[model samples]
Target chain A: MSDPSSLLGALRVVLVGTSHPGNIGGVARAMKNMGLKDLRLVAPRAQFPHPEAEFRASGATDILNDVVVNDTLEEALADRTLVAGTSARSRHLPWPLLNPRELAGRLQDELRQPEHRIALVFGREDRGLSNEELQLCHLHVHIPTNPEFSSLNLAAAVQVLSYEVRMALVEQAETASRKEDQPFGTEWDAPLATSESLERFFEHLEKTLVDIEFHDPNNPRKSLSRLRRLYLRARPDSNEINMLRGILTSTQKAAGTKK
Target chain B: MSDPSSLLGALRVVLVGTSHPGNIGGVARAMKNMGLKDLRLVAPRAQFPHPEAEFRASGATDILNDVVVNDTLEEALADRTLVAGTSARSRHLPWPLLNPRELAGRLQDELRQPEHRIALVFGREDRGLSNEELQLCHLHVHIPTNPEFSSLNLAAAVQVLSYEVRMALVEQAETASRKEDQPFGTEWDAPLATSESLERFFEHLEKTLVDIEFHDPNNPRKSLSRLRRLYLRARPDSNEINMLRGILTSTQKAAGTKK
Candidate 1:
């Protein structure tokens, strides 16, 4: 079996528009405590390398030392295979949602492919992830906090999710060690498409829909978003996505010839 | 079955000889986040009414307001029937130990008797529970953290343990309710699409695909089957199916008029 640390290493935490330096430091500590190494920040409102963050990091200063700061969420998630955005209980959009534990379970399943990089994106402290930001993610994760006082401290939310991921990894390692010495069989015939590929496909899909006059740009009733959600939930493999793009190209060509 | 909140309310978190007042406040917030109400302190070094603690507690100041203080661990355990001391791995004494999840399971089992009181004791930031303090407990609970960086921030530790307890209680309540409730959800605003509607939608989808030159009538390549599988897996509601059919009709009309 492959080393579980590699899997753990592949998972990164992305904080977007964080207002507090202390929370970023606390998140570093929490991630280190659970053996998560990668930390990325997008458009943080707080100053990096601030004294408060350093004080809060305690011994986990190493994580803060190598933190990657990005200008946008899309740039932070450009390389990730799967992305899950943290959301509060209620949102206007109906998206594919999973609880923290379920998110861990899904990650564990995805981590079977060691190259499958994943990102858990946390948005602003007060606003949580915006609808536009959340739409970029394949799945939405909601921590089952007390509904009445549902807003969890950002660092605390990271702590809970990191703890769940650690538990899943530890459990997987234990189960692997307990079993006979044999490699796990690959579950999927084809690797899943990356986020970048999926984005391109979605763009092509929107353009083709407009080309065929099926989707009206002037009066869109979130039809594109609904279709995006549908495809994202499907999680098409690389081959399937290629075929889909091919079909879109053919549809565009056919409509152009008729016109 | 007793109320889950009552069980959670009966479980008290005890901080022994804590040096950080912020941790105390943070603990209160974590406890409140998980629906646990009771908090106790034993010989805390930080000032009880410290502003840092109050600031750290966020909106959970109510838990801090109702906090109980004791002079010694014995006083804190006076009324509790079961006690679990949080410890790091590889202590001097080989005592009866359980992971945080196992401790939560034990608590869930003991909670069958509503009168059973429980205490989870956390020690100082620098040093864990003293040998004598740990001796007073029936079980030692260790959080499974990375050995390289073993010390979890005091509030983060509270968050993990409280999260586990909350999960256990929520699961128990869910299992009990699931047996009594109907199999499927009665909460959906729109009823499911009928088989006839789905079949008609599929037929329309096939025709639209052919018109768009996306599907070959002469040289079939299982593309239609794949599309069928995608739609079937989505399980679109009646309104969604109608919307999809409308899109297909629009696509066909656009293609026909262009031709």
Candidate 2:
């Protein structure tokens, strides 16, 4: 039901520990290019209204003028339901990583919820997102730049991401209006089954299967992980999850001496 | 069997009469980000090896070092099968116009031919493509900018196009590999029917129709133009074009006419 501009309005660009004033201005310029209005600066190295920052902002002075500065990362992302951090290198932990395009698709799904806001967090130009900062994010976004020369300027990185978000939102709006290839309307759209709900379902299913002597919990193999992948791939809806749980409940009851 | 790298190798970025050294550096950085290795600068204002340009180029020093500077636009676009001029504003003449995404699709089609090279020409930052320079291109590329504030930086424009081309090439490579959704392999893939063949087919179709009294040339009520739209939309492969031409010929012969 929401327009692209509304979706864009709900999206915020948060920069952490920005060193250069020109890049701050560049980020503002880039955000405005994609009709994104909100810019949250977290502990910037440079002061606002610097000459270089103003010079680089070009005509996007409004975005620069209206920026919200925060002293901490938590404050910058306080109201966001979904947070994605930008990182160029691999991390030790295999956090759920998504490329820019996949992140856009996830945004499209999340933005359907009323008043839901998303934050795209960009790290320092030199060292990238701190482990603590990155772990706060639900997903990590990688831009997929050339491996040999992937040191993208902070502003250029912002430009690339904002452009993609704009493209994705615009394309979604066009598809919604045209209704071509898009099956049904928002009326038929099923509520997305949350990760918590999915996890709960998995736990319940595992317990019920063990009660029915179908699964041996003592020496469980890769079945749990494999089934996790299968179900996640299915992206089951809330209704589908409820039906599945009902089936499991019946299976548990069918077992001898099981309530 | 061209890889994305090969496609990028065949593609060239030609900047015409660029005035800013920083923008030039930024362009190189943007090009490298999208795996575009070739850059041709036509009569730049700033001197080569400028410190500011180098500084702005960040880690993409290789792209900056290997740039080919030409005295004329012709040299920059030499042997390019498709030349697209980037213009921010609308011009008087109705040149063949395409947005960035469509331009990528055209590139995908054209690059299939042997030794095919394409030039994406970026004009001066302030003035954009001059009438003379724009005329040199076969198509005009207009990035859809926010009307309220459409003054995109020159390097930003380059970044947008380069990003789009990279995405398009990557998507094509992924599609080719999927092999599931695609109906047949590239060997079964038909060569796109050339304009010459389509034009010839149209001529034959028209002449045969006129002789058989199926079409009246005297008072054509936009029939031919409409049919042109139809066939063009279909984008028939060589085999389909020949089959269609055969049907027209048989129809003409069935009407007892020998041309």
Which candidate ranks first by lDDT, i.e. highest? 1
- Provide i-RMS per model in Å: 3.2, 21.2
What's the alpha carbon RMSD for model 1?
3.6
Q: A213 in model 1: Cα distance from truth in Å?
A: 3.5
Measured against the true chain A, the candidates' chain A TM-scores are: 0.90, 0.67
Count: clashes, candidate 2: 0
Give residue B83's lDDT in candidate 2 (0 to 100): 91
lDDT of 1 by residue, B99-173 (tens): 888899899888667678899999999998888999999999999877788899999999999889888887777
lDDT by residue (tens digit), candidate 2, A17-118: 998898898888887777778998999888776988988888788888888999988788766656778976576444456667767876765554554567
What are the C-alpha RMSDs, in order, of all predicted structures? 3.6, 19.9
Worst 10 residues of 2 chain B by lDDT: B180-189
* lDDT (tens digit, per residue) of candidate 2 on B53-88: 887888778989899889999888878888999986
| Candidate 1 chain A weakest lDDT stretch, 10 residues | A177-186
The DockQ values of the predictions, listed in order, are: 0.47, 0.10
